[model samples]
Target: MTCFAIARDDLTSPDVLDLLRLHLDEMHSWSPACKVHALPPEKLRAPDVTFYALRDGDRLAAVGALKVLGEGRGELKSMRAAPDYRGRGAGRALLEHLIAEARTRGLIWLGLETGRTVPFLPALRLYESHGFAESTGFGDYVPDEFSLCMELHL
Candidate 1:
């Protein structure tokens, strides 16, 4: 698929939210604990969160967001891809897009929180494959057995 990145404003468009809702529902169905944080549509308007939407033509197929946490650090959040687009490199595209965006913003490190469950193994692999390594919890995520933190130096 031909994919390109757009700002969070584009990703949070009404149509994009509908797609994200479906993605979240699918993840939730797989595991109740795999909760995708739901932000009011308005919350996505914040400048601190840099979101990238990968689209095929007019359809948004993947999305990922980077939240600046100061101290040359960034937190990855709200990463998901349309179910039909999985295994087609959409996830990797969105991730690499976000990593580039982070560096452009002067962030030296990028980190994220994901579940430690089996279903999240693929998610962990994606980050690991992209050069992210194990890291201590940062931002609002607390240290917990269920959470895995990974970071990559820019």
Candidate 2:
């Protein structure tokens, strides 16, 4: 079974920290330094952001966060499933949890920024399967070749 919770200490746990590092490294490798927007663990701790961890037994399977952008909108941030947990539904579970949370919070739109490169194809497919469609940039972001924006209107 999959279990998820609002991560408090998990964000600081070694396993989770390692996953975050891997995520950031992958982002930077795929996009230019200025276009890499994955937030660090400390940044995910902001009051407007809600972070979560997905666990399987005693293992940390995945991590994701939602940052509240005012005006009935929210942004997905730092979503990553450990390599060992890929194909085990961890990423999908985390995405579903965030989507449900957004709906419950009265957010009318949920958006995300991800790489436009081949390495990001899997993630792009996942979001698209979950009803997210490609969209123009929003919030503090501007349209950039290295980044692709997607949104799901609730």
Candidate 3:
């Protein structure tokens, strides 16, 4: 994680909560409330999900999560880099950490649901660069104009 420390977070830190609130607020601004699927802090604390936080010294750098969706599949969620950490390696470091963690957990496939719109282009590109390919919706997700589903066969 370079200069950043990455760890399994309990989602209770004020910084983590602030980031999640910012994430949800950003999602709502980009899409309708119903189309925004970003999970809240309480939901991210579910047993099936593991939340990670990256920190530079005592400052929050980024946050991300992985959810075991059964049958050797995992889902990425709540990926967000702090405003100060944007354009830095923080986001990539956290993403790489999560991907590696997913593999370590014996996940055969990693997938995610994200918005399909201008605000989400950078995120889409990042996932694509990491080998996530556009795919049909999974789990309870439905294909819609506001949604984009992607997967990577591990």
Candidate 4:
């Protein structure tokens, strides 16, 4: 079995930067500019956001972020697994880590927004498998045809 390390990342290194670019590019490809909600690396540096990376040895396999929405609410952001690592459990591992982090912070709710397009079906399924159910837009988000929102109560 491949051992993966999950840790907080500063999002400045070259490999992590490349992974972020790929994630943004794919999100843009699947959704229009107005519908693309994935945060840029710089925006994720905000005090309320915690960014993490999952690595298999020196290879960066996946990345994800958790943004505190206050009042016991949290949002999952920018979750993406490297193409080569897809279906190999990296995404799931990263997501599980984020959920644990949220619980550790005493968050009562965890929400996320993902594209409604076919490209995001796997992601939707992944979230569903983790006990997230479809939910209305939360925080500053508004309902839109291209976006599917889901939340889990911790």
Candidate 5:
């Protein structure tokens, strides 16, 4: 499979928004606990929230972000690969890229909230495979029955 680097401009491009919406809606259908709360693309213009979109040829294949929450802590948000793009290593690439970016910025730890529901096993496994371990809640996120918190030490 031919995989290309994700370009910065594509992150908020109108063309890629549909791909992101599809991925997010799929998550909602599959796991209610895995909700995306980023204020729409309009509000994502801030410097603290960095978003990326990976493309395969002209097709948008995956997307992810690093949201700086201050105090050397960051949150991983909107990590998703198009349905047809799964298993092609795009997801893994985006994740590893984001993690390395976070480390480069001097973050001590990176955290994420995913579903504890039945449908999220694959996502949980991906995070664990990448060295993220179970962790206590950070940020405004609380310990909810339907969610699980995971973190990686840099």
Candidate 6:
């Protein structure tokens, strides 16, 4: 919420990796191990993925990624705001940045999978406000009770 900048992350910074670990831990807490699709650091560095970090000044405020699925489509990955930055618009800032990047890269739509539980309500609301709606599973994901898929047409 205070002078944050969204920039492409190389996924090698110690703070970025620590935040990613926090994101993974939170995901695992809300869903089964098999259903947790948040990418690991090595996977995030894959050729098709473009990771991002939202820095509030020198501190990392949040992180997210866009994984090119080819054919004018992409998937949103690892959208998480640090505890100290949540509810202060850090997530929204990062989300907008990714959507803009997707558009810049010529992606027509963006897809994401998140938990369907009450614990995930805030995230669901955030995505919905940005025009993401209920959708069938994308990528390697499958439709299931614990999983909620959404898509935003860019």
The top-ranked prediction according to TM-score is: 4
Q: What's the lDDT for all of these models?
A: 0.75, 0.87, 0.92, 0.93, 0.78, 0.92
Superposed Cα deviation of residue 153, candidate 2 (Å): 0.4
Model 6 residue 12 lDDT score: 90
Worst 10 residues of 6 by lDDT: 1-10
**Cα displacement (Å) at residue 145, model 5:** 2.9
Instruction: Tell me how far the alpha carbon of residue 106 in candidate 6 is from the true structure, in angstroms, after superposition.
Output: 0.9
Q: Per-residue error at 121 for model 1, in Å? A: 1.4
Which one wins on lDDT?
A: 4
Kindly give the stretch of ten consecutive residues in candidate 4 with the minimal lDDT sum: 137-146
Q: What TM-score quantifies how close candidate 1 is to the native fold?
A: 0.84
Provide the TM-score for each candidate, comma-separated: 0.84, 0.93, 0.96, 0.97, 0.86, 0.97
State the weakest 10-residue window (summed lDDT) of model 2.
1-10
> Candidate 4's C-alpha lDDT?
0.93
Task: lDDT for model 6, please.
Answer: 0.92
lDDT tens per residue, model 5, 127-151: 9999999888877665566678899
Writing each residue's lDDT as its tens digit, candidate 6 over 1-154 gives: 2778888889999999999999999889989999898999999999999999999889899999999999999999999999999889999999999999999999999999999989899999999999999998777888789999999998
Expressed as tens digits, the lDDT of each residue in 47-147 for candidate 1 is 88766777877877787778888899888877887877787888888888889888998999998877767877888899999999888877666546666
> Which residue pairs come into collision in candidate 4?
none
| Tens-digit lDDT track of model 2 for 1-154 | 5554434343778888999999999888888999988999889989999888888778888899999999999999998999988877889988998999999999999999998888888899999999999999997676577889999999
Where does the lowest 10-residue lDDT sum fall in candidate 1? Answer: 32-41
Best of the two (1, 2) by TM-score:
2
- Ranking 1 against 6 by lDDT, winner: 6
